[model samples]
Target: MKHLFLFLLTLVAFPFSYAQQAPFQDEINQFKQQDEQHFPPKNAILFVGSSSFRMWNDVQSYFPGYTIINRGFGGSTLPDVIRYAPDIIFPYHPKQIVIYCGDNDLASSDTVTAKTVFERFKTLFTMIRQKQPNVSVVFVAIKPSPSREQLMPKMKQANILIQQFLKTKPHTAFADVFTPMLNDAGKPRKELFREDMLHMKPAGYAIWQKALQPYLLK
Candidate 1:
C-alpha cells in the first residue's frame, strides 16, 4: 500500500515539477483550457516548434482547406519541445505533424552544435513514432535568416542531417524552406524578412506555403 501510495504521489507531483521547469507554463495551461472547451478534431495537422509557428497566427489561412493546429510557443528549443511533447504533441491524434524548431536551437545564445541539434531531433522523431506509429512527420528545414547570419553554417548542417534522416524514414518529408529563402549570393534575402531580419515576411511564408502545401493532408 505504501509503495502504491508513493507511486501515485509521484504521478501527481510530476506534472507540477515539469511545469516549473518548462519554459511556457502559462501558454501550455491556456492551450489545455481552450482544448477542453473546444477540442481539436482527430487526424488534423499539428504544427509545433518555436516562436516562428506561434507567430504564424494566420497559419490556417495559408493552408486554405486544411485543419492545422498551431501549438507553437516562443523561444522554444528542441529539448523544450521534447519536454512539452506530452502536452502539445502526444494528446492529439494528428494525421500529420509539421515541425519548425531547430531554427531557435541553433540561433539561441547557448552553445549547442549542429550534431547536438540533429540528435535532439532524432530523439523527438523517435518519440513521436513510438507514440503514433504511422503518423506522417514533415520537418521544416531549419530556415536561414539575416538576423542570425553568422549561425547559418551550423543551421545548414543541422538541416542537412535532418533532411537525410527524414529521407530514410517512411511517411516523412523534409520541407526545404532554406534553399529558396536564399539569394543568388547564397545568403538569406533581406526582402524575405521583416525589419527585424529574424522573422519571415509575407515573401518567406509564401515560399513555406508552397513547399509544404503538397504534403498537407486535411
Candidate 2:
C-alpha cells in the first residue's frame, strides 16, 4: 500500500516538473550537439530560428561571397532560440544574424497570447545584445502562411513592436518582408507559398535573399 501511494504521488508530481523543465533540457541538449558543426566560431551570417531557417536550401549559393550558416531547426520557438543562442549563433561570431521564429509557436497554439510572443521576443533580443554586443541583429517579420493567415493581426502587432524597437538602435535592423509578400488584398501572394501554403516556395525565398543582401553587404 505504501509503495503504491508513493508511485501515485510521483505520477502527480511528474507532470508539473516535466511541463516546466523537460522541454528546456531537450532544447539545450539539441543546441550543444548541433551548434558545434554549423557555427564553430567562423565569420559567417547565422540564420537562426525554426523551420524557415532549416528550409533555406541554398543560402550560400544565393550569397556567394559570404559564409552563410543555417541554424534553423523545425518546431522551435523564441524560448528555444534563447536557450540555443550561445551554441548556434554566438559561437559562429557572426557579422549579422537573420532571425525568423514565433510562427511555429503561434501555429502550434503553444503560446497564450500575442503579448506572450512579444515578451519572448523582447527577452531574446535582450539576451543577444548582452552576449553579442557588436554583432548585428536582423529580425525577419513573421510571414503570412495560409495555415496561419488567421493570426496575421497578431503578427502585425508583434511586427509593430519590432519596428518601433529597431528605430532606437543602429545595429538592430528589421527586414520588412511582410509588406512585399502581401498582395493588394493584404493576403500572402499565392506564388510565394508552397503547395501546403505554410512554407515558402523558392520564389518567396528569393524575395528574402534580395532584401537581406543589402543589409548584409553593408
Candidate 3:
C-alpha cells in the first residue's frame, strides 16, 4: 500500500513539472552565458523573433554602420517571444527593436487567426513601452514564403493589423518586406528562398535589408 501511494504521487507530480518547463530555455541560457562573457552594447538595434533573425548571421555586414543584437531563437511564435522578453529584450536597453514574427504564430495552428497575431504583437509592444517608453520599434512585415503559401492571407492580414496599430503609436515604423518578396504574378519569389522554399537565401535578406534600412536608427 505504501509503495502504491508513492507511485501515484510521482505520477501526479510528473506532468506538472514537465509542463512548467519553458521552451527554448537552452538558447536563452546560451545568450545569458554570452552576455556574462561580454555584455552587448547598450542602445543598439535589437532584432528579436523567430528563425528569420536568428539565421541572419551577417546582419551587421548588411547594415554597415550600426550595432545590432540579434536574439531570435528557434521557430518561435509570438508567445514564445513574450515569455522570454525579460531575458532577451529588456536587458539590452535597445535604441530600436526590429521584430520579425507572427507568421510562425499563424502557421503554428490553423485556429490562430490574423487577429490573434495582431493581439500578440500588441501585447509585446505594450510590454516594451511599459518598460522603455521611448525606444523605437520596427516590425518587419511577414514575408510570403512559398512553403507556407497557404498562410499568406493570414500573414497579410496580420501585417495590415500590426501596421495599423503601429501608426497609432509614436517612435514606431512598419518595414514592408512583404510586397517586394512577392513576384510579378503576386506569388512568393522562389529564387529568393533556399531549397527549403521557406527560409531565405541571400537574395531574400537583400530585399529585407533594403526594406529595413530606412527605419534603422543611427
Candidate 4:
C-alpha cells in the first residue's frame, strides 16, 4: 500500500512541477548578468526567439557592419518570448528586432493551430510596438525542416499568416525563407539540415543570411 501511495504521489507531483517549469530561465538570466558587466550596444539589431535563433551563434558575422545582439533561448514558444520580452528585449534598445519562434509551439503540442500561433505573435508584436513605436520588426518565415516534416503544413500556414500580417504594418518585414528552403518537389531540402534533420547546418544559416540581409536596417 505504501509503494502504491508513493507512486500516486509521484504522478501527481510530476504534472505540477513540469507545468511550473520555465524553459530557458537560466539562459535568460545569464544574458542579464552578462549585460550588467558589459552592456550590449544600444540601437543594435536584437534577435529573440526559439532554438533557431539561439543556435545562430554567429549572426553578427553575417552582417559585418551592423551591431547585433542575439537573445534567443532554445525551446521557447511565442508566449514564452512575450513573457520575457520586458527583460530580454526592452533593455537593449534595439533599432530592429528579428524573431524566429512558433515552430516549437506547434510541435510541442498537437492542440495549437496555426491561427492560434499567429494570434500569439500579434500579442507580442503589440507589446513591442507599445514600447518602441518606430522599431523595425523582422519575422523570419518558418523554414521547412526534414525532421519536422509532418508539422510543415501548419508551419507553412503560420509563416504565410505572419508574412501577410507584416505586409500591413509599416516598418515590419517578413523574410520569406520558406520558398528558398524547399526543393522543386516542394519538400524540405535534406542538405540544409543536420543529421538530426532539425536544427541547421552552416549552409542553412547561409540561406537565412541572404534572405534577411536586405531587410536589416542600414
Candidate 5:
C-alpha cells in the first residue's frame, strides 16, 4: 500500500520536475520584475524580446509622441517570453506590440530545432492575438548580427516562417531590418556592430529607428 502511494506521488512529481528544470527561467523572471516596475501606460507601444530591444536605451526618443514601452530583456528566448507573458506583457493592455526574439533560442545550446522555434512563435503570436484582439503586432526580423553570422541561415528560415504568418493578419507587420543591415556582399556590416560583435552599435540602433519610424502611430 505504501509503495502504491509512493508510485503515484512520483508520477505527479515527475512532470513538475521536468517542467521546473528550465535553465533560463530565473534570468527572465528578474527582467520581468524590472519591467513591471517601469510599466508603460495603457494604449502604448511595446517592444518585447531579447538584447536588441533591451539595449535600446532611447527607444522613446526615436519614436516621440507615441508612448513606447521597452519590455526587452537581454539574453531571453521566445519560450522564456511565453513563460512570463502574463506578468511581462498581458496586463499592460498595449495598443501595439513589436517583437524581436528567437535568435538566442537558435544560437543557444538548447538543441531547439528551427521547426520547434516556428511552432513556439505561432504559440506566442496566437496567445497575444487572442488576448489583445485590437492590438497591432509588428515583428522585427531577427537581425543579422556580425557575431552570430554563422547562424544566418537558421535566422532566415525563422523569418520566412514568421513573414508568411504575418501575411495572413492585416494588423500585423514584419519589419525587415535584416536586408538593410547586410552589405553588398550579403554579410552583416562590421561597422554596425559593437566590439562584442553581437550587439548593435549606435549606428545600428539609428538604422533600427529609421526603419521603425514610419510604422508608428501618428
Candidate 6:
C-alpha cells in the first residue's frame, strides 16, 4: 500500500513539472547553438521580437550598410522576451535594439487588454535601460494584421502607449510601420501578408524596411 501511494504521488508531480518547463526553451537553445558555431559581432544593431523579426531572416540584406543581429523567436510575447533577455539582448552588446512585439500579447488571450501589453512593454524597456543605459532603442509599432483585425483597437492603443513612453526616454524612437501597412480605406493591406494572413510577404517587409531605415543606428 505504501509503495502504491508513492508511485501515485510521483505520477501526479511529473506532469506538473513537465508543464513548468520554460516556454520557447528549444528556440532559445537553438540560438545558443548558433552563437557557439559562429557568434555575431557585438555592437551591431539587434532586432529582437516575435515572428515578424524571426521571419525576417534576410533582414541584413534589406539594410545594405548596417550589420544586424536578429534574435526574434516565433510565437513570442513580451514576457517571453523579458524572460530570455539575458540570452538574446545582453549577450549581443548591441549598440541599438529594434523591437517589434505586443501583437501576440493581445492575441494570446481575451483577458489581455491594451493596458496589459503597454505595462508589459514598459517593463521590458525598463529592463533594457537598466542593463544598457544608452543603447539606442527603436520600437517598430504593433502592426495591423488582417487575420487579427479584431485586436486592432487594442494594438493601436498599446502602440500609442509605448510610443509615448519612448518619447520621454533619450535615444529611443518609435517607427510607425503600423500606419503605412494600412490602406487608404483604413484596412490592412491583404497583399502585404502571406496566405496565413499572420506573417508578412516580402512586400510587407519592404514597408518595414523603409519605415525603419531612418531609425537605424549607423
Residue 3 C-alpha lDDT in model 1: 100
**Candidate 4 backbone collisions, by pair:** none
Error of 4 at 157 (Å): 1.1
| Candidate 2 C-alpha lDDT tens digits along 104-162 | 76776745467777788889888878878777888898887777888998888888887
Superposition TM-score, candidate 1 onto the true structure: 0.89
Find the 10 residues in a row with the least total lDDT in model 6.
12-21
lDDT per residue for candidate 6 within 1-218, as digits (tens), equals 99999999998878677678799988999999999999999899999999999999999999999999999997999999999999999999999999988989999999999899999998999999999999999999999999999999999998898999988999999999999999999899999999999999999999999999999988
TM-score of 3: 0.92
The 10 consecutive residues of candidate 3 with the worst lDDT sum are: 12-21
- Note the residue pairs that clash in candidate 1: none
Clashes of 3: 0
Cα lDDT listed for each candidate: 0.90, 0.79, 0.95, 0.92, 0.84, 0.94
lDDT of 4 by residue, 1-218 (tens): 99999989998878677667687788888998999999998999999999888999998899899998999997899999998998899988899999999888898889999998999999999999999999999999877899889999899899899989989999999998888989999999999988999899999999999999999997
Per-model TM-score versus the true fold: 0.89, 0.81, 0.92, 0.90, 0.83, 0.93
Cα deviation in Å at residue 210, candidate 3? 0.2
**What lDDT does model 6 reach?**
0.94
Off by over 4 Å in 2: 1-41
Cα RMSD for predicted model 6: 2.4
How many residue pairs in model 2 have overlapping backbones?
0
Clashes of each: 0, 0, 0, 0, 0, 0
- Cα distance off (Å), candidate 2, residue 32: 5.0
Number of the candidate with higher lDDT, 2 or 4: 4
Native-structure RMSD, model 2: 3.9
